[model samples]
Target chain A: MTTSTFSERGAAAVGSAAAAAVGDGARHLIEKRAAAVDAYPAMDAMRDRVREIRLHTLAHLDAYLADFADSVEAAGGHVFFAADADEANAYILGVAGEAGAELVVKSKSMVTEEIELNGALEAGGLTIVETDLGEFIVQLSGDRPSHIVAPVLHWTKEQVGHLFADQLGVPYADEPTELNQIARTHLRRIFLRADMGISGVNFAAASTGTIAIVTNEGNGRLTTTAPRVHVAVMGMERVVPTVEDLGVMLEVLGRSATGQSLTTYTNLITGPRRPDDDDGPDEFHVVIVDNGRTAVLGDEVSEVLACIRCGACLNICPVYRTVGGHAYGDVYPGPVGSVLSPILFGFEGREELPYACTLCGACLEVCPARIDLPSLLVNLRERVAQEGTAFSWLDRPLDAYEFAATHPTMWTASIDGASLAGRANRGGWFKRLPWRGKTWTSVRNLPAPAVTSFRRWWKKHHGA
Target chain B: MAAHTVSVLDATEGPIVVPSGSCAAMMIDHYADLLSDDDALAAAARRVAGRVREFTQFVVDDLGLDGLEADATGPITFHPSCHGLRHLGLRGYGERVLDHVGVERRPLEAAEECCGFGGLFAVEMPEISGALMETKIGHVEATGAETLVGYDMSCLMHLAGGMRRRGTDVEVRHIAEIIAGEDEA
Candidate 1:
């Protein structure tokens, strides 16, 4: 089986050749996040309060789900519960059918990406375009988003220059201003003509049936207002009990996301366009998609669903900083991806994703909702290790180590054996290995297990 | 794991010290949970965990970096492992040791980052591990320091391994090894 994650192409992107660039990019983003937190000393207190709020909400999630749906219906908006991706896509397509929509403009929404909504609409013979600039860039490049907040951060502007020249047939422009102007000119035309707009809900308040969407660009506001029909797709967990809870979540969202005090736009849409409203969509629909989140609700690791999607975890994750997102082989990447993907999908194809991290707990530190990512990762690994297929080879050391650790006699012998092995290498390390340890030794040296066990030394000296 | 905890309980009394922070974290933070189902084992774990300390913490608190002699003279960089700084609350201890010992603790670029020796993770995702190591090592060289000290051995082991494979002369040692007056290169 393929044990290593570094395929030929992935090796080049995150390997030594580009490691510096990757590290710098990650450091830059995390520093911005840190500065925002540093600027607001009370961020930790706010983080805890919101975490408690989410903890309470998630505990009564079954009740709240019904409450939310009822409130949405009462506010003159339609609420559809979709159980899986196909179901969600089918429901949204049916809504498009009922509305007789020709073109759909989408604000940047990860859940829509999660359900592959654009493809479903396109297959049903409707044109769709992503209105977020970063989303627009990845769309044109035919690339899945490499990051949650900044989708195309993996590609340099020079590469985008080439992509635009080749794909858009526009004059190559490397400057941010020029490229933005070019995109604005192109998407602005589409925004005006779109019959339906689809957006992702950052947070939904159950009490008033208000949907909150955050954006750095004006596109989200325009997408909801200009289109005649508006459909918002949200992962089922993206709801809070009231508007006040949305305010506290918003406090952490922008600061944790891009270090902005608040995003350029935080659209709090209450129902569709009202009769008194001058400019807005006439029909509003909320698609609360389960897509496997309901299954995660009562599990031991259920707290993972409390994620605010601010992506603070990704910015500080060492594995994400090193390998980049595409290597994760999942919709979400980094520490959160490792936990969320295996649970949502299954443990079969994505077994290695949970093992991707060093379990550093960096993600937990920056998390706005305070998800204990490292603990969840270890628990996931423990579950994986429970499988017999895991013990065949890769985890042999882990299994052996567990046995040796518990068995004092065998552990002592192994220590003595390592002591003997250390004598052969004057440098005091094993330069190569005789077994599958080549996975480790091929790139670096293994310190010989301490020649004399610490217990043995303590007994010899201190008479324990 | 239960039997191991019993053995540890039989052997230790108070103030058990581990050289590596990751080991200390497992003992201090995880053992109780690992033995949670059994009340007796869980209580025993909590007792043992309360006494557990990383080497830096032991030296600074119990031994009190008050009178320790300064040993290493050259410029030194400190690699703060993820487990040590984040999990076990290990920061000021390393600085206190370096300060009292009169060693020059040069700040590392990305000093709080992981060196990517995640036990079995190095084997499972070797490319990502190696790439992270490359970034950390590049910063170590940029510091122009002759040696690197860390609170955890695993991180140093990974750094030392990468340095050996790359044939770089930068040396790696645990903070205990540094304070104990060992000259390694």
Candidate 2:
């Protein structure tokens, strides 16, 4: 069932057993991430260096973006700078039409999801297939991806088995190896017959004009090479100044993402099929998507673009663990999404995203790039308050609290009143409350104020 | 509010000890930045910031309150509140204080995970906040501890409210209240 609004979705997920499963998966990854970082002491230094590299690259993005475009052209590859999602999709459709592409296979690309590229392609009459196992399951099930690195982390084996039986008309099999074989058998045919390949760029090296695609499965290689035309979609911030910078980025990305020293395959595609190349796409295209990135770059939350899409923030975020990804109601979820979504998609109706977090700062702790997530979230909240969208309801109580806080007499009077109320409650605790306070009382009781104010006690004891 | 706080605190000669972890963090980590525009208040904020110490940190680290004695009902678990643990870099000041008291301390699972009492967070996003509290309480119960102690009163009250609602036997206590050897609760 589709839930409306983020709060409704959050309430639904938090109460379900799925929350537990998401928590377990997140914890498992967190363990691996921690162990991987601990095992390689150099990774700590690399983390600091990568953050510097990302910041430096972003600072000189204008110069580097031009250099990147020039390098791609020099390497015999076409580059398209898309100001938004529509432009990105329109250009891709133009390329596909020129190639007369009918079937398209995609390696996992969050940028494509951000742009809603798959739906646009299918609408443009191209049959699209997701080559990533997790993404394939998500597509077959008609469900949105729930995690960054592991999209199907929310799905159980039994659920996938049932989805396969219902969607793929396959025999029921829940065993891991059997499930892998079924998906492999089903996807292998699409890989060969696919006319166009679409993949996401993990890192776009500006100096060399090489786009790196890191994947555990070999689908990234096949998706980039098997088809007659290859297209790479990347967020413009994915660019790094030098190939050496790309190496440091890759090191931190692998350790923080899945706790692996490195992914099984890291494909660095420079250009399309060359004179000496045995295999590759004939036409290579790179779509550098802006899609609100420049706006974010200008904003105070620009440090968020430094993210490498490592889901460490998600795995370590207490809020994400409880509500899962779907509750975020956006393509990007977790701490990064909370800050990015509202800024990217206007904070008009999406004001709740920043408040959804508890400002735990756990995300910053685990973040490989060490983006200050709490500060960004608080900044968005300040904007939301200024916009007066959702937080208007809080104005009255806050005003009263502020009044009480500023005025010593009123503060003392309020304290005395609350102390009297507390004295009325049995054992100085309230089992339930009414009105706005019902939010807390709905799930938990509140501690009543003490019978005597600390000031009163101090004065009486000291006889002051 | 910060300016008012600084003005009031500037008159005091003693170190200003903040009992709440989040409050202490705000004073130490954010005050100077918030007041930087006013040169006088900025210097004063820094002075207050330097003197500010989390209650448990001050007791254990500054006062050198070692080898103390206290009493509690059964094994207890501690939930390190997020602000104190991360911002103030409170490394087991409360736990070390408790160690001196010689209470049987049971390890709380995922001790560093937030208790979800993020100021307005519990009231604004109740479902998510309650869900996190339930997860935290589950670990607290799993420790089989009769008492749960934490540095922040906000987190303790949140956990206590959830426990009261669930009819769980675990009691919540602030580390200060426990250190004071009070039977109130």
- In order of appearance, the predictions have TM-scores of 0.94, 0.97
Clashes of 1: 1
Candidate 2: tens digits of C-alpha lDDT, residues A26-101? 8999999999988998976888998999999999998998989899999999999999999999999999999999
Error of 1 at A48 (Å): 0.6
Best by DockQ, which number?
Answer: 2
Each model's lDDT comes to 0.82, 0.89
Across B1-185, the per-residue lDDT of candidate 2 in tens digits comes to 78888988987988788887899999988889889999999999999999998989888778887656676757888888999998788868788887778888999899999988888988888888888898899999999988999888788889998998898898888887777777432
| Candidate 2 accuracy as lDDT | 0.89
Looking at model 1, the pairs that clash are B70-B101
Q: Per-residue alpha-carbon lDDT of model 1 for A286-360, expressed as tens digits? A: 999999998999777899999998877888888887767777766687788889988987777667677778888
Q: What is the TM-score of chain B in candidate 2?
A: 0.94
Candidate 1 docks with a DockQ of 0.60
